[model samples]
Target: MLCGGTSAARPATDETQQIADKVKPQIEEKEGKTFDVFNAVEFKTQVVAGTNYFIKVHVGNDEYVHLRVFQSLPHENKPLSLHSYQSSKTKHDQLTFF
Candidate 1:
């Protein structure tokens, strides 16, 4: 892929779930609602100075949310942070950079 461009969307893996779990609380707090079913289903990634994870999460029923979680360069010793999110989405929605 072109440098600094987003990668193609792909099925979420264990690592993806782990990343999503780390940022779930932040998302829930902002939305003012907790998600009982927080499962990462699909994702895309953009490599910046660090990496930005664009994830499609299944939050039970027909509800989905797109999350942008940023991970700083390992040596920086920074924790993953929830950069942004889009709620009230569906399973069919494309997981893209936001």
Candidate 2:
């Protein structure tokens, strides 16, 4: 018989931070803006044999950005992947903002 239990949550590891650091510059360049603040909202590991990280960033007044970073398993030796775009519009629409 096998039993499974949830693991305790852990703070962001150095590797995760490094992934964020590596992706931030690209996001800033593509968005043509500087981020005043950035927060990681989600992290998943061993999902689909890789890791995923989601980040929310504030670029300026009423401007918000979301980024997703995917890192393949080390055994695969694949390069990191990233996707980023403005998320505030959707948030506003959902909130019924005019």
> Which candidate achieves the best TM-score against the true structure?
1
Q: What TM-score should be assigned to candidate 1?
A: 0.97
Residue 59 displacement in candidate 2 (angstroms): 4.0
Task: Quote each prediction's TM-score.
Answer: 0.97, 0.53
State residue 66's C-alpha deviation in candidate 1, in Å: 0.2
lDDT (C-alpha) at residue 86 in model 2: 43
Task: Please report the candidate that would top lDDT against the real structure.
Answer: 1
Report the C-alpha lDDT of model 2 over 1-98, residue by residue, as the tens digit.
11222123334466656776678788778767667655443233334457555544344566655556777889999877775444663223221111
lDDT of 1 by residue, 1-98 (tens): 78999999999999999999999899989999888999999999999999999999999999999999999999999999999999989988888777
lDDT minimum window of 10 residues, candidate 2: 89-98
